[model samples]
Target chain A: MSRPTRTTEESIARVLPELDYSKIALSLVVMLFFAFFVSPIWTGLVTAFKTTGAVTATTPFVPVLPGTEGFTLAKWTRAIGYLSTGFVNSLAMTIPATIVSVFLGSTAAYGLTLVDWNERLQFGILILFIAGIFIPYQAVLVPLSDFWINLVPLVDILAPVWQLPFLEPDHARLLSLTITHVVYGIPLCMLLFRSYYLTLSDELVEAAKIDGATISRIYRRIILPLSKPMIGVVFIYQFTAIWNEFLFSLTLIGSSSSPAATVTLVLSGMGVDLSGIDFGFRMAGAFVAAMPTLIIYVLFAEQFARGLAEGNT
Target chain B: MAGSQDTATGSRTIGGGETDWRTRVETFSKSDFVRSFPYWFVPFSLVGMGVYGGIGWNTVISLTDYEGFDRPDYTNLDFSMYAQALSDPWVYLTAKNTLVLLIAFTTITLVLGLLLSILLDRGIRYKEKIQTIYLLPMALSFVVTAQFWLWMYNVNNGLVNAVVGVFGLGPFNWIGNPDLVLGAVIFALIWQYSGYAMVVFLAGLQAIPDDQFEAAHIDGAGVFKTYWRVIIPQLKSSSVSAAVVLMVFALKAFTFLYAMFGQYRVPKATDILATLMVREAFMLQHWAYAAAIGTILLVMALAVVAPYLWYQYGQGSL
Candidate 1:
């Protein structure tokens, strides 16, 4: 949809009247308002000090400050034992998936907007990508997962390069999950890139072409360099999305007792197995596992702002 | 190859024609490849074809009983799955919960985002820093935020209890008990998403000129009247934008619930449709039944959103 266009005269004339004060009073209620985000888990960071009795003693209440004045690393030590392998498993899933999806997504977007492809083919693929967004992952998970498991043999036979990184070939299960996540991310990546690309002058692209730059070379030498901000934004979006993914990892890795699981699957396992329901440790583990995403946010806030701003959703 | 050799022999430059022919062949191949990029790019369109085919198939899948690798018995399938999914007290309750969370989160996020945008617009000092800090959660994944909150919401050692301890209150069961689980999840959503909505509103607010506010000020227009009669109406698009996004997010929330509540949390209590479909169908392997729930969910989302989309389209056309 087009952005609504308003004339300056109309804009001023409309605002000729003032607004109500009480209408936005809640805005000024900083303590209570900010509390919405902060209050929910405000004391979680400090609660690392309390003994288990002191913890469970509160029943369901979270302590703003635990009774134990001194800190204890017991939870940390225990958490490592509980979730370390899971953390490695999750990383193994996220890192490669994030890299591949970002590459494929940008390529699709570039091809659609910058490179001239058949018009119907362009929209067809674009729509294909878009349509996947609305379909719940659950609807496709079963067939899709099975499709991945089934793909292992075919990939080995047809695309041997896929075998180089995938030595076991059985681990193609992870690659299957990766493909699905990548496929899901395609539309969004294309939408973001194409929108941003629209803002760039075609003269720039033509200029690069005049210098005898190959299509791929022009993309690397020119477009890629110019698109750093958007790249950062895409990176953050994909990083968080792929990193925090739960179900695929759970199904592929966690459900089996092959002594392997992604962090999400393990973290989920924590929730499942929690008879005492270790909220403190579980939450801690969740945060620790999610640290990479948090770090990306802190590091690249601007990229996220610009990138998400143009998200087609 | 022979024709190129004949041209080389006919070259007035004699034997040097061979070198020229080689160069000509090299340039021709290079240019031909360059000119043929449009063809080389065809394979990539497969991604789109794959996507579109997926859409068609998913639509069909939603309607059928084809569960994963299991052979489907579509003939036996009717509205049984859909009816059961809809009739299930849990589905109904979760639908209600979903609606409540959508409204609460959207309303809260929209209001706060609008206010934050306006506050920053009014030239709040350190505006940029606050904006970044606020937007930090938006950048963080839902899973990360959920996990972070899972820690923060921990009863025994959670920061909430620690803070409340001085006030002489016990730690509340944030994710554990069914009573507060929905609220906890909602809080998690707001924390992560409000900043996202705020940035959108802020961008819209930026596009709004200062002259309008100034004119309202000179006209004896109080802040409220200016905002109510002027600002609010103008922000209709932004409001719709925020509402639409928040609604979709609430509807699609899986990671948050799954991370916090686990798969089997009492179905009716905290189970959103997305999670319910997977929990029942995939986890429980109730293939036909889960497919039914998924179909219902697809219908529900479209039923709720399709109207708004059409309405937006009509308004845009006008």
Candidate 2:
């Protein structure tokens, strides 16, 4: 028994939708944009693995896989060796600064919501926190430096009288840098936490209040537990920011001999050579310095994107 | 005084002229200010002192001729620094550079980001993966991006020159040539932040209902026409928010440039008010002059922020 042959329209119908010219064009454009976006980092990564000679001699687009002079661990070792102290210092500052900022900011955001003050006073306080976001770091650069320097005198005067340990002015620079980062981070942290908290139902807060929970008690018991996602978002957000901060670190800490130098300062301190930059070493160091944020992005991309999107909105 | 205090307490007796003293105390304790004061105190004080107080102090320094000193001398207060900054050719050049960067970088990033977002929103496959690929750069630090771009923009063996060379374009000394430095830096910045703008625009695009597209199609509108007329207009808020953030970052590009060159002294071509401020204060010890420049930067930042705040207020979201 012979089967009827399919007509042109039937055959066409049997086939799945072919992407039209516009769709094909769109896919190409999208691919190109993504390619452009990914190229620099990919090049950096490839260069990081390459030997110095290969870095200068080879085409940048080629991945430096195993074999040839394309691959070497020398750059990574050297870069890490040079930047170890900087990594330590950055972590030392960023972890504490992130914690402090998140704590203060979350509390402040919670307070803003729970407070029963007059509308103007409440808005005024909220606005003050928001306004911090717009204050250029340059505005605070000179004054903050002076403030830290002069703080030593105040500390000296108080140490003997209050039986406190005295600190040298220069030694306090690291502390000042941490404080600056913490303070600067608060506005953003508070904004994120506040917006997130605003979305949560007030029933929990109301119930806590009715149950005679103190403000701190409410925050610790009800809000804090409920705020895990937001805390993660804020923590990562602030961590990434405080980790990458340069101006405050450079200005406040300068190029101190101690391990107080941040990763950014240390990486940046790897000044471009006049003859030729060791592209391999630079790329390796760049990759290492970027690892933490990159890890955060890879692992918690949703939270990161949400946090940033929330901040803008 | 003791008797009056006793009466004040007694006036709060059960069903009396007022509630009991205990009730009044309870009210006081329950007051929002008292209840929430501890929570608000630390952040408010720190931010107030660190930010607003710093601005005030900077203004004071700008009014005096404080230079090459640990402490700013407030003895002879005047606006000489401001006058000098206004008249200096360097300041004028820096200001112009700042404006150019602010306008050019923002407009380009926004347009690029909008295009990317629209493409992604139009039923792209592997949407999440593709979106993340575009967004990966935003998570990188300025130090990293600067370092990466330096190598990429190298005249020899750099990916940029190599890619362009294929199209028969000559190798461009992207960083060495003063004329190209600003553009190069701006391009790097766009690479880092256009993802940010895209994410914002994408969110705006997603919020728009699918019916809008269907309706536009029914009306015989092309995809481009639908996006231009029906979709882009709805992104006004997103565009504003993204623009404000981008512009502010542009003002703060001092750090990026400083990191790129590994010094306070960046190439003159890329000198914005921010880099100029840092270099003058830290490098040249022109404390008062830098302060004046800082004040101007603060004003520019405020100019960008004021409208956003006003918009939020209008939306009753403040």
- On lDDT, the candidate that comes out on top is 2
Q: How far out, in Å, is residue B76 in model 1?
A: 7.0
B21-95, model 1: which lDDT tens digit per residue? 776775555552344354324424544444444444444554565664565554653565666666788878777
Write down the C-alpha DockQ for each prediction: 0.28, 0.43
Q: Model 2 Cα displacement at B202 (Å)? A: 1.5
The true-versus-predicted C-alpha distance at residue A155 of model 1, in Å, is: 10
User: Model 2, which residues run further than 4 Å from truth?
Assistant: A1-18, A153-171, A256-258, A271-275, B1-11, B14-26
Share of native interface contacts present in candidate 1: 0.25
RMSD of each: 7.3, 5.9
On residues B1-318, what C-alpha lDDT tens digit does candidate 2 reach at each position? 233345555665545533665556656666667768889888999899989999999999999888886677899999888888888999889989999999999999999999888777766678888888998988888988888898888988888899889899969999999999999999899899998899899888878876666676667665566678888999998999899999998887877898788788889999899999988888888888889999999999999999899998898777
How much is A246 displaced in model 1, in angstroms?
Answer: 1.6
